[model samples]
Target: MTQPNILELAKQGDAKAIALLLNRQLQPKGITATAALKDGCLQVILEAVEVPSQQVLAAYMSKSIAGLGAASIEKVKVYGRQTGTKVPAWNQEFEMAGQKLPVADVSETRSAISTEVTESKPLSLKERAKLGDVEAIASLLNIPLRNKGISATASLQDGCLQVMLEGDPVPEEELAVRVVRRELTSLKAGAIASVKVYGQQVGEDFPAWNREFEIVAQTQTVKQNNNVKLNNHNHTLGDSIESDGLQEIAKNGDLNAIAILIQKSLAAYEVHVDAEIQYGVMLWLKLKSDKTLDSQACLNRVSRILNNIQPDKIVSARISQINSKNPKQQAWNKYLAFKEGQFIDNTKAVNQMTGAFCAAVVIVLIFISVMYKPTSTTSSSPASSSSTPASSSTSNSTTPRTFLGKSQTGYELWADKNCVYVKGMTEGDLARLNTDVWRFKDEVKLQTGYKCVLFE
Candidate 1:
């Protein structure tokens, strides 16, 4: 039957057909095959009368089974063994007179197994280093380094492994010692034999490995033995201690040593008795009085205080103003209000001055009206004479005297200053002239007794 028909039969779980087909294919090379269906997958086991190398046997089995075209076979396990041996032929073994022996005879055998088993089992420091395990080396170096918030990674290079460490910009000596101790415990010490260790901050592509030891070791002795002293006092801040302690004290509003330092620094100026910390670091110095003090001087005083207490902890400091309720600030506000009132008073004064000037102009116009006088006019009187005391006296006078008389067309008389000025007036021009003549005649009568004639 065709290969496709054999695969079809195997997929249907026909054990007999699958075994027959595999045997037919492998028997030519003195190999026997067995087929079993387990866990929904076809398992093939092969045996050889004359054992061959694993590579050769595996290749041969792979090719022969591929030729079978078994679609249902999910896993292929090719085991080669001599026709009578129970042990698999692929495993390393020693043979004496055709009898298999254990791998203990090879000296390097233990080391090779150590490399594989170390990943699963816990071993001593020396055993782990001998096996050249990357994880074990990293763990050993990181024990003390963790205190400095540093971590390391190991990779094998040439005969020695390289450990690349990363952490704070400032390196601590204790971290380096931990790394060196691990290296010494793992392997012998020599320029070529010792593991190479270097530190860098995160994001630094290249680290100065040659100078790293010198840089980290420079202050090692000093920093290790002592803590950072504040001012001339006995209080000290250790390298391992964080800035959180200082922040806590500041949050509680207790100036403590910080206040003492500031008070001494700014002895020339009046300093505030109380100080406050905002947002953890901003030191607010409350002033006792609102005097024009130098801002830079205050800043210098704050800087001196910080340098003594916790230099790196406080980012910035400044002098705070006195409260608004202070007497000095209230007086300053009153002065400003007085200036504003002066401006308003000046505006009102200007308005009153303008009104006075307008009143003077009106009074001057009235005075001119009261003082005005008009000149008299001369004209021939009518032939009809009326016998009256005032007219008889002015009969021979050539000057035309004003007379009170009715108009020929209209009943109207013109008079001025309580005296008759014109007679028989019919038009507006004659009437206006009559009124002026009357005023002049009245003035003449008052001065020389020349009276105006009144005609009925």
Candidate 2:
């Protein structure tokens, strides 16, 4: 019998037909199995040793039932039989055949699956960034900015940058304001044009508005030369230090030069100076006040001196009193979790395997079975004119409707008024296509994990 006839017979609860179909589908994938229609589901029993992971087996069964177009089959329950175990260790249910099956509440199974999936492939920085990786990006940004008393966190949403700086007992307002300004100015000219900076003292819900600033690409001009000069202003730090051309070096965007210049100028304050580039074109200068020095006073003096030296060249400049109590420690635990060349989405991997299996079944069945055709019956009637005109007359309109077609990648493609659908396509393939062919549309959720739809 043809594959369609066999599938139709299986729907009628013919055990032989169901077994034959299951064997035909599963055997080629190295899964020796038997199936029967029972209790409104396709009950599949697999040889324990032949069964792989539950997720892999679930995906295979889902794709197989979908291929058969068996709407009567509500779900698929898989059980594995081992030599010694009295009860099967592998028992899982998967929704199929248009049925709204309840999600399995197997927490232990899910936890084990998650651990297996995550440990198999840890995410790298580049891979995570491509997926808009939130945790990885935040960890990377926080690593360089960690210091005594102050901590910085970074988050990116839709390519917009948000940086939050927190200090215990709050830093001097003047210092916070300068730091926020410098950071924003530097980021505005980089690849990240939109930036929001927030500063808050530890234990506060709201940020200090006076210490906040925003920068957008449209309002800012890109500095062509890194050596742009800062405006000179009168300061209490004496003319001798001012005449040393510290402002000129700050304008050069040289972190080492800027750090040396600031250190020499503030040596009298007995502060420890450190500097680093926070982001593109933005430099961070940190000054730790000694016990004998008044932290707030030293911050004020540094802010005034730095603010005038490179006001225009610097994107932002801040001088803040680092919190003495419970300073936040920088730990890039997430970044460290990144293992190079080892990022894998378990779902996507399973989907690809399932798609390949389905595609193979489709190709094989197409060659073995005749294409299914609907039967049509007709009867001749005499004296149709005497009957009602409406009964005899037929409408001849043919509305345009979307139908499945073949894609270059061997996926089945269909487009409706709202979205484009594809079967046998993996998420990775969909992502690559989204960047090229499906650039303007977003993906729509699909009931079948093996299929994907892009919204028009």
Best by TM-score: 2
State in Å the error of residue 194, model 2. Answer: 2.8
| Stretch of 10 with least lDDT, candidate 1 | 332-341
TM-score each candidate. Answer: 0.21, 0.21
RMSD to the true structure for each prediction, in A, is 42.8, 33.8
By lDDT, the best candidate is 2
Candidate 2 worst ten-residue window by lDDT:
330-339
**What pairs collide in candidate 1?**
none
lDDT by residue for model 1 over 154-248, one digit each (tens)?
Answer: 78655566777777673543335334432343243232244566667767877545221210111111111122111332332322111212221
Question: Following a full C-alpha superposition, what root-mean-square deviation does model 2 have from the true structure?
Answer: 33.8
| CA-lDDT, candidates in order | 0.42, 0.44
Give the per-residue Cα lDDT of candidate 1 at 210: 23
